[model samples]
Target: MRVAVFSFPGWGHLRPLLPLVRELLDRGHEVSVVVAERFAAAAADTGARVLTYPSRFPAPVPEVRTAEDLAQVVVAYYEEAFAALPAAWAAFADDPPDLVVEDALSTAASGLVADRAGCPVVRAFPGFAGNDEVPLNGSEPEPGSPDLDAEHPAIAAFVRGLPDRLARLGVGEDAVARVRARPPRANLVFVPAAFQPRVECFDGSFAFVGPQPPADPPPTGWSPPADGSPVVLVSLGTSSNDNPGFFLACGEAFAGTGWRVVMTTAGHLDGATAAAMPPEVELHAWLDHHAVLPHAAVVVCQAGAGSLMDAFGHGVPVVVVPQQPDARVMARHVAALGLGRCLEGPVSGADVRDAVLAVAADAGVAAAVAALRSAIGSAGGAARAADVVERVAAATPTDGGSQSAWR
Candidate 1:
């Protein structure tokens, strides 16, 4: 079988899918991946033929301060990204693949391509699958407030512009709606069922496949300190590490506490800030999370899905300081699950210290982590995701629709 995969530019979106792509290749299927030029090299490492495209919009500004700011960022990103769909389809015009697999956020573009080619498309959720049962992007609706009948002005404007944006690509407004509303043959969710909000409501159309293991090997020359103090790993994820204040706060919180702190800046931290960190803290631009997670007694992070799920996989509790709405939702869920505590808004070093200490002292957190770890282990990570893909490809009709059991 020949498969084409689409993903957004961020590592959070690309990393989860690589393990599945590699699994498909190992099974003798031909795979091609379409992603931003920034991720071309990383995608190629999966052994899939890689196709890179350019975006008209500039990368999202890291210092997103408000929900409005984030919503605008989403609109700009999709507007620019979907603009590239025509060229992407033209590249495969002569030789279309059997199926299209894409991250959930890439639905607009990938959906258009699948519709044009008349092939079944699989939607993969690397994090939360937004539905009526759960709040979108981790935003909680105010209690006693009526649901709005109309979309937000910014969002409505973006929706209105969709037709003009993809008109050149032969995707009409109705086609776009169908792509957005049409359910996938298989909805591959990369978190365990226990981690999902209101998991009982979702039918078999969704598979609660657990987190994919890191495709890369563990970092070399890194070992846990032999000191008996507990280890705290701090990271802000790759896309949103622009906040030096958070890192500075962490340094002050754990300084001289006998606990070893390993912080990853993802190359966003400045030299002056790094030099100012306390001697008890070790700062690096990046480290193998899979290698560091096992030794961590508690994780201090921004609650990105990949990092949060990885901590759970290793049975380590977390103190989540979410920087975005989606991450705020994950952090809330973590606190609700008894797996960790959340620091919601602008926090300080003392806030970080208190949350970390609270999580460390909570015995229940350990038990919760252990339960989630077992659930994740049994959810069939990358291998199960591959099985679903193969099944969908075999069962889907060539006329561009799917007749899979889940559908």
Candidate 2:
């Protein structure tokens, strides 16, 4: 089988899909990955054919606070999708992909590719999958906060205009309708069903495969401190992680605490500032989580779905300080699951220290972590994701023809 995979530029968006790509390749299938120029090397390292497109926006995506901001974000996401279409088409021009694996948010790009190839698609969700029973992040917005379901006129206008734009590109009505349909042909959620909210609502169409670890772990040249103190890994992921205060607070929190702190500042801190950090804290611009998680005893992070998965996969607990609404929901889930602690609103160095210490010492949290790790093991990682992809591909006709699964 020939498979084509698509994901956004960020590490969080691209990382989860690579392991699945590697699995497909190992099974004697051809795989091609379409990603932004910044991510091309990582995608290529998986041994899949890499197709590059220019990124549409600057790094550290601006926070979305207003309806207009949300609309702008939608526009930028599609812009990147459209930019990616040509490279994707060219890479599979002679013989189109039999299956297309998509990052859940890359709907527009996936729809266009599937429309052209007339193939089945599997949407990969890095986090929770929502239904009528819950929102996408798997939790309800706080009272008076903007509900994800609420329709803002700006966002509505963009959505309303999509059909016509798709039409101009020769995407037929049937194809558009199928792409807009709910409960897609197959949804490969990269989270265990045990961790999903209201798990009863999702049917067989959803395969809750937990996060896929790196097929080939990257080298980071990092190791635990020789003093043998427990290690804490702190990161806020690639985007929306420009909170200097949070990073500084973390530095202060672990200072002189007999804990080895490894942090990924993502260049949010200047050289002088980073150099001034406590002797026990080591800061980097970026480091693969796989290289750090095995040695980590605890993680202090921003509650990103990918980050949480990395911690849980290793049975490491977390102290989540959410910086966005979606993250807030995941934070609650962490606390509810007894897997970690959630720190809400503004926090001080002392608050972070207290939470990290408290979560680390909690016997109940350790048990919950063990249970979730077992669940992740059973949910299947890359191998299971490959099975779902092959199953969805098999559902297509043998004559290399299309079906309603991806009209």
Model 1: residues >4 Å from true position, as ranges?
A: 56-71, 77-81, 132-167, 170-174, 177-181, 213-219, 396-407
Cα-based lDDT for every prediction = 0.80, 0.79
Residue lDDT tens for model 1, 359-382: 888899989999999998889898
The TM-score measured for candidate 2 stands at 0.88
Candidate 2: the clashing residue pairs are: none
Clashes of 2: 0
Clashing pairs in 1: 118-400
Tens digit of lDDT per residue, candidate 2, span 306-372? 8998899888999998876668888889999999899998788789888889988999999999899
Best by TM-score: 1
RMSD of 2: 3.8
**Candidate 1's TM-score:** 0.88
